[model samples]
Target: CKTIFPNLFLIIHRNIVSTVNLACPLDLKSIALQARNAEYNPKVLSYSAVIMRIREPRTTALIFSSGKMVCTGAKSEEQSRLAARKYARVVQKLGFPVKFLDFKIQNMVGSCDVCFPIRLEARAVSWIYRMVKPRIVLLIFVSGKVVLTGTVGI
Candidate 1:
């Protein structure tokens, strides 16, 4: 039987990172509401409800559909990870499970400095690398040695 039905579905998954610095006191609830109603491309099937959470006294979360999330007003990488982990847990608790997409720490201080010291950063980096497990291209900084890890998708 030949039937006319939509067979192809394109799911565009995007994750965005943003930052906000507020000078004066603001209403978090109202701000979140405004973000919730903010428009996006018409091709978007639907905009997911914005999930707002406070990472600390400064940071806030604005989560959207398809695992897209933005952590705003964070000061440090520690703060960013804290917010992202909290948001990820909340999404999981809400029964929306998504594979770890991308973990980024923006607006960070010195390139060498991190929430935790080098050891901890190495461990977390290793863990995330294993989790996402993307193809890695290694470049030797000083010597001519290279280490390649993870599986590449072709």
Candidate 2:
């Protein structure tokens, strides 16, 4: 039964990063205080944006003051969108007019092992290699660890 489809490729999605526009201004300090799962630190340069997390989809979102949100850690495209919508709803509930707009998948990452060590040195590629397909980057390691990134969808 397993040999029937030898060409079947399994792309194990490790994570999906997506972006969405709320189309309205947001106050990071207010969101952090109102949303239980949201955190914001204005003094910290690394955490300039409000970080929000959801348990249902196990995704985290970075909410900027400009109403732009970046959602990450979803296993699939649908999951990413669902998580982003959830984040947007949370903001909307905080009394900010939220409009879900320009929702797009920024990057999709998939990882797989070839089951054998790869000779990356012979390839002489840089730390990261790009796939033949446009907008696809493959990070191949010597230990047979391959990461496929820069894809918009699964």
Candidate 3:
């Protein structure tokens, strides 16, 4: 069966590196001291995570001492993985045994460049997406995107 679909356009994209194992606990103090671009200040409630960024993928990583990491700012899947890997490698080089754990896309939220009015039909996409939290959401570019968290079989 052949079907026609509306042209798709992407204005911006965001991906996350769910989680990774640094293998062992990390000393944020050492990491921050080692890199000029890295920073860590627990003085701030929400700023406890060690912040790190790489220029290549242009992403930021929130590395926790518990060996979990959250990477953001990659425009594509490939770029996201590369960015995460770069973060792990950098930490590994810092004498922390880092391991590339389950690195996968958490969600892909995109907005079209077209200004025309468009309808968002969740039911239509349900068969493929299976589940979309909140059922319906209005995306208004303000630095946040929709998150579809679930496990689907291939």
Q: Please, what are the lDDT tens digits per residue for candidate 3 over residues 1-154?
A: 1224335433454443445666678888898899767989988747568999899888888988887888877777778888888889888898887888777666554443343333445523212234455442334322222223232111
Query: Model 1 over residues 15-63: C-alpha lDDT tens digits?
Result: 2244322212333333344442233342443544354756252556655
lDDT of 3: 0.65
Better of 2 and 3 by TM-score: 2
Deviation of model 3 at 36, angstroms: 2.9
> What is the alpha-carbon lDDT of model 2 when measured against the actual structure?
0.86
Model number with the top TM-score:
2
RMSD of 2: 3.0
What lDDT score goes with residue 100 in model 1? 45
Q: Residue 83: error of model 2 in Å?
A: 0.5
Q: List the residue pairs that clash in candidate 1.
A: none
What is the RMSD, in Å, between candidate 3 and the native fold over all Cα?
7.1
Which model, 1 or 2, shows the larger lDDT?
2
- TM-score for candidate 3, please give it: 0.68
Clash pairs of candidate 2? Answer: none
* 46-131: candidate 2 lDDT, tens digit per residue: 66799999998999999999999999999988999999999999999999999999999989999866555667556654358766
Model 1's TM-score against the true structure: 0.37
